[model samples]
Target: MLVFGPVRVIHCVAMITRVDTYLHSVPLSGAVAEQVGPFTLFRSTITWPYYARPVPGSEATITADDIELVRARCAELEIPLSFEWVVETCPSLGAAAAAAGLSVVEHPLLVLERDDFRPATADARLEILPTEDDVIRQARAAVNLAFGEGGTAVGTAGPAERDANAPAVADGLVATLRDRMLQGVSVAAGAFIDDGIVASGNHQPVDSTTEIVGVGTLPSMRRRGLGAAVTSTLVEHAFDHGVDLVLLSAESPAVAAVYERIGFHQIGHAGAAE
Candidate 1:
């Protein structure tokens, strides 16, 4: 609310709420390859809508021969691709996304640096423990609160307290992760407010990168430093590894502001393609 400078809506986020439109309505919907001119265009609805992995120099092809040839080759391989400005994490495919008329959607990070990240109530003790029980229980409670009952789905849910619910990693909707690590419970912390698990969050570590996701606070604990404290602890935990940058997406602008105060920038948007 007070952290971000101003909100920007280059596109209406509500457009893709249906969960099946883009993958079904678009021309290239789910086609492995589409024949257009000499180019065989491929398509897929994975990760972000406009995400891609391009073949270097090959992606730089502006000439009819190479460009068209690569398209056909890609089609033969049944590879579907979406174009986003490729990062170094990607193969150095020269502006293929740009060549395809895609622009660099700002990948935001912490716009500010370290500031005093204190909780609203210092009376309660916030402790981080390496386990998933707290996160799971809080997640279940949050889900129940967000939805009426039996609505445990994840992602841009109507609002944590409206009628929808928290967006989970799908396969493990009740499982708490994207991978198949059978990640028992989880590694997390519990924030005690007044008394009991008033706030809970989980920070998962992958190799060297860690993301402090699975944040949930009791209804009575809303608008407090519980989320901030849980997040900051994980951040400091990640910093122990000398992490250059920590990134995560926030659906609520109000909460995003809190992260901003702790130094997080809006890195554009993340879309779920049905």
Candidate 2:
């Protein structure tokens, strides 16, 4: 068994492989198609153009030609292509993207094992809610506001110019979240204040590992440890239900420190190009 940081590694191949596969498999409104070679292309209304690397068990070398192919596709769609990969496993991919004139940023990868996770002492009105529930609207709104109000997470492209509450964009996001929840690929947790969601998160289970994402507290409600509480709530629920591992990509050093208090340790680094 391979060991990384303080926990026995759960997804040994690469964190990017696992996360990309999960996103590709999930039901989304946009285009999800496999390209030539070991690559997957995703174009969605709610996110930047995603170019995923080869799935595990495939030995495909990504070359400049592959990058150009992806670039061409993104160009046709009029969207910026954000190619992400585990820096430890695919340095060549990062190099290729750099040579192609895309800006690449490397960030830390964090992991928490069930046995190793240190659960927080108290829960702050955390509830696991389905995406189809009435409360989901508020949760979705909270996520959009969090990302829009805060700086974009590391390894992720920034949101588009339009505000999240714009009618058409909001509708697309709501529909996408509903589909994800109804399909059982994702579960959401929220911290409520007087029946309204103030902080929210989503966890997507991929095989034995679950990826915790979208954990955010309302801007007005920050500084009370709500973000930490919400993240721990998601991880604890997954582990209690038998998830072997949970992983997340920390957007910055300060964000990484927040998770470290919840018992996640840095395992590796991931690079994103836009």
Which candidate ranks first by lDDT, i.e. highest?
A: 2
Put down candidate 1 lDDT per residue, 204-250, tens digits, no spaces: 44444444555665554555566667777767665665543444545
Error of 2 at 109 (Å): 0.8
Residue-by-residue lDDT tens digits, candidate 2, 208-260: 77878888766666666667788888898888777877888887877888889
Q: Find the candidate with the highest TM-score and give its number.
A: 2
- Taking every candidate in turn, the Cα RMSD to the unseen true structure, in Å, is 12.0, 5.6
What are the TM-scores, per candidate, against the unseen true structure?
0.45, 0.78
